[model samples]
Target: MARVAGKVALITGGASGLGLATAKLMAAEGARIVITDIQKNKGPGAAKEIGGDTLFLEHDVTSEERWQQVVVETEKKFGKLNIVVNSAGIGTEGTIEDTSLADFRKMMAINVEGTFLGCKYGIEAMKKHSEPSSIVNISSVAGLVSGFQMCAYSASKGAVRLLSKSVALHCARAGYNIRCNSVHPAFISTPMVEAPLAAASDPEKARKRLLRMVPIGKIGEPNDIGYMILYLASEESKFVTGAEMVVDGGCTAM
Candidate 1:
C-alpha cells in the first residue's frame, strides 16, 4: 500500500517536527524523499533514518538561490520532481506593537518568501515531467484566526494561505497539471510549539493553556498534520487544488 509510490518529494524543514513526520510517512509509503533543513547536523541523520532513496541537504528556504539549487539537486538525484512540501518556517510571539519591523520582515521572509520560492522553483522542476504534481505549503491555524501574541506569525501564514490559492489558479489556468494547496494546523506537538511551552514559567501549565484552545481536550501530534500532507501529496487528492485544508482540532470551528 504505497500511497505515494513512484513519486519524488522534497520537504523543507525536514530536520524535525511536522516536516520530519511527513518525510518518514511518505518514505514508508514508498516515495523517494529529499529532506532539507538549516539544521545541517540533524538533516543528514533524519535522511538516513528514513533510509531508502532519501537524501538530505542543508538549505535556507528564504534564499531563492538555494531554492533553485535544491530543486535542481532533487531532480538530479531522483530524475524528476513530483511533490514539494514547503514546511520550513518560524513562529514568533508578539503583539503588533511589541513586534519590531525587523522581526516582522524576518517572519515574512521565511514563512512567506520561502514558500513563494519553493512554489516558484518547485513548479519549474515539475514542469519538466508530464505527470501530475503537487505542492503543499504548511500554513497554520493562526493563518485562519488571530491571536494577540501572534501578530507576525499570523501575518506570514495569512500570506501563505492566499499565495497557495494564487499558485493553484495560475497553474490550473495554464494546464500545468500541478496542484497547489495550503495546510493549516493547530497546536501540534512539535518543537515549534514545544519550545514556546518549554520557555514558559510553567511548561505543563502552558501546555494546558494551549490544550484549552483546541476544544478537543488535547493538542495535536505531528502525524496529525503529516497525514493530511500525505493525502495532498498523493494522487488521492488529484482533484484538490487552491483549497485550505485545516487540521485543527475544532479550534477554527470555535
Candidate 2:
C-alpha cells in the first residue's frame, strides 16, 4: 500500500520550494492534498501538475481568519484532516543591530505567528477526524544554532521550534491523538535562497560560501526535505512528537 494512503494533507506555502515538493510526494503516496499559498498564480499550476488528488487555495499564513477558512474548506472537501505541513516561511538577512522593528515583526508574523496559527487550527481541524493525525512545522537550522546576520530569521524560527514542542506536549497532556514536530533544514536550494544569492555582488562566490557551511559539501534539494516531511506526515513517525528533525546535510554536526 502507498505510505500515506487515504490520508488528507494540507500544506501551506505549497506553491513552490519545499512545500511544493512535499505536496507532490504526499499526493503520490495516495494522500489527498490541499495546498495553500499567497502565490495564487503559481498555485493553480502546481495543483494541475500534481493531478487529481490535489487542490490549491490562495492563502496568506499570517491571517487567522484565512487559516480558519482553509481549515473549513479542507474538511468540507476531504471529509477528514490527517496531516498539516506548515512550510510557509521567509528568511531575512540582518544582524540584530541592523534589523529594524518592522523587518523583525514581518518575519515574526510570517514565520513564527504563521506556524503557531497552523498548529492551533490544524489540531482543531484534525480532531474531527476519526483517526490520529500529525502536524509538521518547517523550521530551519537557524532555529537550532546562531549565525552572523541572521538574528530576526533565527529568532522567528526559534519561536517556531519551541512552539512546536509546546503544542506537542499540550496535545499529549490533553490526551489528544495528535502529534506535532518541527523540521530544521539548512540551505536547501530553492527560489527563496536563489533570489538572495543572485543579488550578491559575487553570486557564484556567495553560493560557494553558503555551501561550505554544510559539512556534506552540497546544498539540499527541495525533495530532500520533502521526503522527511512525508515520513513525519505518515504513520511511520507515530512515536515521534515534540522532536526537531534536522535536514541540513550535517551542517549542525560541526
Candidate 3:
C-alpha cells in the first residue's frame, strides 16, 4: 500500500517550498490533500499540480476563525482529519537591540500563534477519527540553536518546538490516539533562503557564506524536509510523538 493510503492531510503554507513539496509527496503516496496558504495565486496551482483528490484554500494561519473554518471545511470535504502540517511561518533578520516590537510580533503571530491554532483545532477535529492522526509543525534549527542575528525568527521557531511537545504530551495523556511532532531544518535551498541571498549585493558570495555553515558541503532540497514530514504524517512514524526531528545538514551538530 502507499504509505499514507486513505489518509487526509491539511498542509498550511502549501503554496510553495517545503510545504508544497510535502503536499505533493504525501498526495502521491495516496493521501487526500487539502492545501492552504495566504498566497492565493500559487495555492490553487500547487493543488492542481497534484491533480487528484487535492484541494486548495486561501487561509491566514494567524486567524483563529480561519483555522476553525479550515478544519471544518476539510472535514466536510474529506470526511476525516488524519494529518496536519503546520508549515506557515515568516522570517526576519534583526538583533534584540534593534528588532522592533512590530517585527517581533509579526514573526510571533505567523510562526507561534499559527502553529498553536493548528494544533488546537486540528486536535479537535482529528480526535474524532478512529485511526491515528499526526500533526507536523515545521520549526527550525534556529529554534535549537541561538541565531542572534535572526532574533524574532529564532524565538518564534523555538516557541513552535516546545509547543509541539506540549501538544503531543497532552494528546497522548488524554488517550486521543494522535501524534504531534516538530521538524527543524536549516538552509534548505528554498525561496525562504534564496530571496535573502538574491537580495544581497553579492548573491554568489552570500550563497557561499551560507554554505560554509553546513559541514555536509551541500545545501538541502525542499524534499529533504518533505520526506521527513511524510514519515511523520504516515503510520510508519506511529511510534513517534513529541519528537524534534532535525533536518539540518549537521549545522546544529556543530
Q: For candidate 3, write residues 1-254 as lDDT tens digits.
A: 99999999999999989999999899889999999999999887888997796999999999999999999999999999999999988887999999999999999999999999999999999888778899999999988988669899999999999999999999999999899999999999788998999999999999899999999978999999999999999999999999999999999888
In angstroms, give how far residue 161 of model 2 lies from its true place.
0.5
Residue 150 in model 2: shift from native, Å?
Answer: 0.7
**Index of the highest-lDDT prediction:** 1
Clashing pairs in 3: none
TM-scores of all candidate predictions against the true structure? 0.98, 0.98, 0.99
Stretches of model 1 off by over 4 angstroms after superposition = none
Instruction: Give lDDT for model 3.
Output: 0.94
User: What is the model-wide C-alpha lDDT for candidate 1?
Assistant: 0.94
* TM-score, predicted candidate 1 vs. hidden true structure: 0.98
lDDT tens digits by residue: candidate 2, 94-209: 99899999999999999999888999999998777558799999999999998889999999999999999999999999888899999999988899888999999999999999
Select the stronger candidate by lDDT from 2 and 3.
3
Off by over 4 Å in 3: none
